[model samples]
Target: MALPPADDLPPLRAVVEAHGLAPRKALGQNFLFDLNLTAKIARSAGPLDGFTVFEIGPGPGGLTRALLAQGAERVIAVERDPRCLPILSEISARYPGRLEVVEGDALETDLAARARGTPAKIVANLPYNVGTQLLINWLTANPDAPFWTSMTLMFQKEVGQRIVAAPGSNHYGRLGVLAGWLTRSEILFDVPPQAFTPPPKVTSSVVQLTPLAERLACDLDRLERVTHAAFGQRRKMLRQSLKPLGGEALLDRVGIDPTRRAETLSVAEFCALAQAL
Candidate 1:
């Protein structure tokens, strides 16, 4: 018998059940099989016509189907789970030339090279465990040669807060500083834990990041080093905590108050300290 039409393909629930594909917590898999939500995410990416979209962890092809339906010129989906490959292939077949599946770890793939041939945009509900690291890698790619023009990705509420957190906020830390230095980030909307197939304990949110035309004019390596040291002891004052990086001396070189804590420092101030190092 001919397979069900791609657009008319069985719901993700049916597909998962037919395949006996329970989401693997170890892989950080929480399948978002809700078509309405997936379509909403796709639409939020905006004007995908002629745009090459890159998706990570397309479990059960919910987001993949949405992108294809929304007129994306082409979509390259990277999936690590071998079990999910067949499901994605069904999507590839349904969409024909529009969908391509790359079965491998997203972290190891060279996304920049993948984007070399097309105008790319990244939209996905990222796996919880490795989402931040993947984002950092993507943002730190050659800034001059941007791979994806923008990112519409999801993260746990706490991670989302850190991504868009401002100085002096309790959520502000290494992630905030780095994200601020690299991109313009905002929390688009919240998704309750119940939205996932196997609900995560914490709420999740969509975060959209557009890389800045120019970097924050600080040494990234040093900035990360300083933030790592400072936030590593978040509760301690700079004089006491930054002691490892030169302590009060380090603050003096940067012209910052030794008594100030990491949370109190602005991104610019943090950048300055990183440069001073």
Candidate 2:
């Protein structure tokens, strides 16, 4: 008999149990078994019809299956856990040529190369341990020509707030500055911790970031340095907090008031400081 369509596969929990794959805390695995929720996330990434979707930590293929069923051109999932490979292979077999599973740490893999110069998007429920760092890696991968056209990611809610936070908000920090400087980011919606296989202590949010078609170009390291130092001592005045980076002189050169606190600076102001440095 012909196999069931890709969308008609058994429930995610069944598949996980069949493969003896239990969520591993060591690997930051919290599988989302709800297909409807996963599908909403897939659509939130915008049209995936002709773009490759690069997914990280696709435990049990919840979002992977959703991306394929939603019409992604291809999905290259980088999974660190060897246990999940079999399930992913099952997905690949069901979808035939549409899915490719790479067994490795996503941190070390080059997703851009995987896309092979084609327009691509990244959608994943990133492992908590490396989510922020992974985002930084992608954001700074190559500012001049970002490999992924857009990124739809899930992060701890507080972290998500920082990404889309504006100047003066308590959430505004290094992530906010960098993300705001490079792209337009917004929190699509909140995902309660209860949604996962083994729930996390904190709530999560799905955030989408689209690169600005035209943004003021600035050096990544310099921006990182400025934000790190400035926010490192967030309550201090620019003159005092930015002392390691030429402090008062740097602010003056960038036409910023030295007495202003780090949180007062806009994303553009932070970039200005970096460019001035």
Candidate 3:
């Protein structure tokens, strides 16, 4: 006789306990066990009826389960931890062909390859240690041909602020300039510290990023170079801080005030300086 259909897979807590998957501090793991919260995050991605969603660091398959139950056409989950693979495998078996768990570091993996030309969106709580770096890498990977339609991601509150910050804000930095140059970003909602199994010391927030059809025509490499020099010594005025890169003369060449500080410059102004360099 055929066995009962896996009991629809027990609650995430049961899976976590069964597999002894306590959140590993080293891995920056903070499992979101609440179905309500996970479902909310899934919905935040807009409709997934015919769309493929990519998830990173799906520990215990909490968000993964939510995505499947929410009617995602397919989910390609990139999980790094070997220990969590078995748990994710169980979810895959339960969900059948709906879930694909790739075992590897997200940073080293090529997302475009896994995408396989499907209409895709990225939805993940993200690994805290490398989330920002991963985002920057993805945005700059092929700015001309952004693969994913949109991104719904979780980040530390400070990082979230930087993502949506204006040019004059203190939180504005290289992240701000890159995010502004590449995509239109906004903070969705804040996730309380208690929302996780092992709460992070600081609060977190979800951010939605949609790439602009056309961005300011500027060389990304040059933009990065300019921002790095400007923000490297943010406290110093442009004249003093940018001496290594041609100083007041450089600012004058770009038609920017020599007395201005890095944080005060708009993304366009930075791009101008990069182009002038």
Candidate 4:
């Protein structure tokens, strides 16, 4: 039977019990059974009338149902856990052409190419262990012509803070520089640990990142090299920490103080260093 738009989807708990699926910690699965919370997250992506939502780890399909019900034109949900495949298949059947379940690890998949030529919005209750890596991959992939229009994702609260962190904060590091340079990121809301099926120890937050229409020209590889070297020895002054990447000579040429630490350097400074490298 065709599901009634998004309204007829069963309660997530019922579905989970019926399927006898217990979220697997090894896979970083934390199912969100609450419709209200899922709907809130889905709405954070704004109206999805013409967007393809690329979701990672749509366990039991809570957020998937929300995305579909909210009128997303299409949703390409990538699942790594085989246990969730049949559940996801049921969701796909309900929505018909609107949902595509790609059975594979999101880390190894090239989602951008799959959605090629089409604008997409990535919204997911990302698997905690792989969430940061996935975000980095999406941001660093052909930034000049990004596949997704925006990304509203869930992450550990600390990771969310790091994404929007400014220079001089403890949270500021390579992630802050990358996100600061490429997108406008903000913490949308906090989702308490109790919200999950088996609550995590730390709280979680939803972060939304919208890419800049124009970004400074910088080679991604060089930028990563510069950040890895600098932040790798973050406590040491740039003179000592950046020794691998030309150290004082590079800082001197760029008008930066070699005595300054990595945590205090602005995103622009990092981009400058990357360019000069």
- List the global CA lDDT of all models: 0.89, 0.92, 0.89, 0.91
Error of 3 at 133 (Å): 0.9
lDDT (10s digit) by residue, model 4, range 1-277: 3333346767788888998999999999998987888888998999999888899999899999999989999999999888888888888888899999999999999988888678899999988999999999999887888888899999999999999999999999999999998999999999999999899999999999999988888888998999999999999999999898899999988999999999999888888999998
TM-score of 3: 0.95
For candidate 1, lDDT tens digit of each residue in 133-223?
Answer: 9988887776556778889999999999999999989999999998898889999899988889899999999999988888767877788
Angstrom error at residue 73, model 1: 1.1
Q: What are the models' TM-scores?
A: 0.93, 0.96, 0.95, 0.96
Please report the TM-score between candidate 2 and the true structure: 0.96
What residue pairs clash in candidate 1, if any at all? 243-247
lDDT per residue for candidate 3 within 186-275, as digits (tens), equals 999999999997989999999999999887888988888889989999999999888988998999998899988999998889888888
Model 3, CA-based lDDT = 0.89
Q: How many backbone clashes does every candidate have?
A: 1, 0, 0, 0
Off by over 4 Å in 2: 1-6
- Model 2 C-alpha lDDT per residue in residues 1-277, reported as the tens digit of each score: 4324448788898998899989999999898988888988998998999898999999899999989998999999999999999999989998999999999999999998889999999999999999999999999999888999999999999999999999999999999998998899999999999999899999999999999998976889899999999999998898999999998988889899899999989988888889999
Worst 10 residues of 3 by lDDT: 1-10
How many clashes show up in model 1? 1
Candidate rank order under lDDT: 2, 4, 3, 1
